[model samples]
Target: MALSVVMPLDISGESAKYPALFEKMGVDFTARRCTTPEEVVVLARDADAIITEGSQCPIPREVIENLNRCRIIAGTQIGYDTFDILAAAERGILVTNVPGYCVEEVSDHAMALILACARQVVALNEAAKRGEWGFGPHSSHIREVIRARMDALGGKTLGILGFGAIGRSLAPKARAFRMRVLASDPFVDAPVGQEAGVEMVDWPTLLRESDFISIHAALTPETRHVFDENAFASLKPTCCLVNT
Candidate 1:
């Protein structure tokens, strides 16, 4: 009655954990990169526990319907829209994910992206490499690159799409920079974000007033491609967009 766990992506801790707890529990959870529908179906149907990555390998309705043993699924990261939780629940299955895993690392990543875009890190680094400093744009395509560096995060609004762990972590960073934080997360109450010094604003206000829009939403049927053409059209042309 060993629990077999299958992974869609590489789990960070393996050599240390495997053959230790798993071996002791009689659970031989072999983590493998999911490759095909057949492989997914076979592993998922047989597994008592499953750990998935992103939306790439969808645990389909057939898999859920036919699976006889699967009872628990733990996604490796925050987004579990790939797995059919409703179906899992219908079958009395417990589906879980790591919501705030590496919160600081993610916050640091978002800030790095934001700052890189703001400071034109690439363009300037290239300029310095070529024995050029405070250099102007080389072409019309890049004429606006330097302007990105001069822009201030202060006196501007930072709009976060989803107020999950990453969003919560970003608030203090934005506050440190003297920027006002506005976030939208239908699932999270306004007070939750407000406690972190972020004012929860509606989508329209976030779009209109924000100088920087950061996407932290979980991808779903509703949210997939949410940042498509029309959304971009709605954004202020000068607004910088960062995603994590």
Candidate 2:
């Protein structure tokens, strides 16, 4: 008998490729758009393996306890915060995630957001649509537009909240634009930061000094709401933030 693989999430349209890919690998794959823990428990109880997008379909302790024959719980995304790793381990099931899947793509998006914010691209585009060219003394918001600063990326500081793979990828991209990169990660050491060509700094220093800040940290008990009121208050008035 072929091994059974179950995906307890809605895998449609573009995601339909997964079924075909699994077929080529000779696994008996089933994609069920499960919306509840009960649904997952029913569908994956006797499966050999389970694959899911961790963020969308949470596999809590209760669900893990019901996966009788599952040998592995594979999260197709980088973060697997939705799964109960301890519960899976207790049941002899391995929990795995794809950390390198979107490193470059996510870093590129962060850079795009940083540039767009620095130049006020969206605001300018809206103004242009409203027939405001932001010049020649005829525009109503000329003062605001002129005071937008819209400074170049050269010589500005960029602080990254995490020095993980995505953050490491972003450092070189920021350097290419002549920006100084700083990073803050309680788990990362100074030597690791040095190797990545970023200055290791505390959160306070990063908040105070960076002209642009990009958050690349995984959501956890410690990092949840890390940029609260106090953090925002510490930032430079002109600082731009990008969270991805």
Best by lDDT: 2
- The lDDT per prediction is 0.76, 0.90
* Residue 85 lDDT (model 1): 81
Give TM-scores for every candidate, taking all chains together and pairing residue i with residue i: 0.85, 0.90
lDDT of 2 by residue, 40-73 (tens): 9999999999989888898999998988789999
Per-residue C-alpha lDDT of model 1 across residues 1-244, encoded as one tens digit per residue: 6678666555566433654777787787776667776777766677787767656566756667777888887766777887788888999888888887788888888878777766688777776676556435544324555554557677878899988888889889988989889998889887788689899988878888888888888887877887778778888887899987
**Per-model RMSD to reference:** 3.0, 2.1
Model 2 alpha-carbon miss at residue 67, Å:
1.7
Relative to the true structure, candidate 1 has a C-alpha RMSD (angstroms) of 3.0
Clashes of each: 0, 0
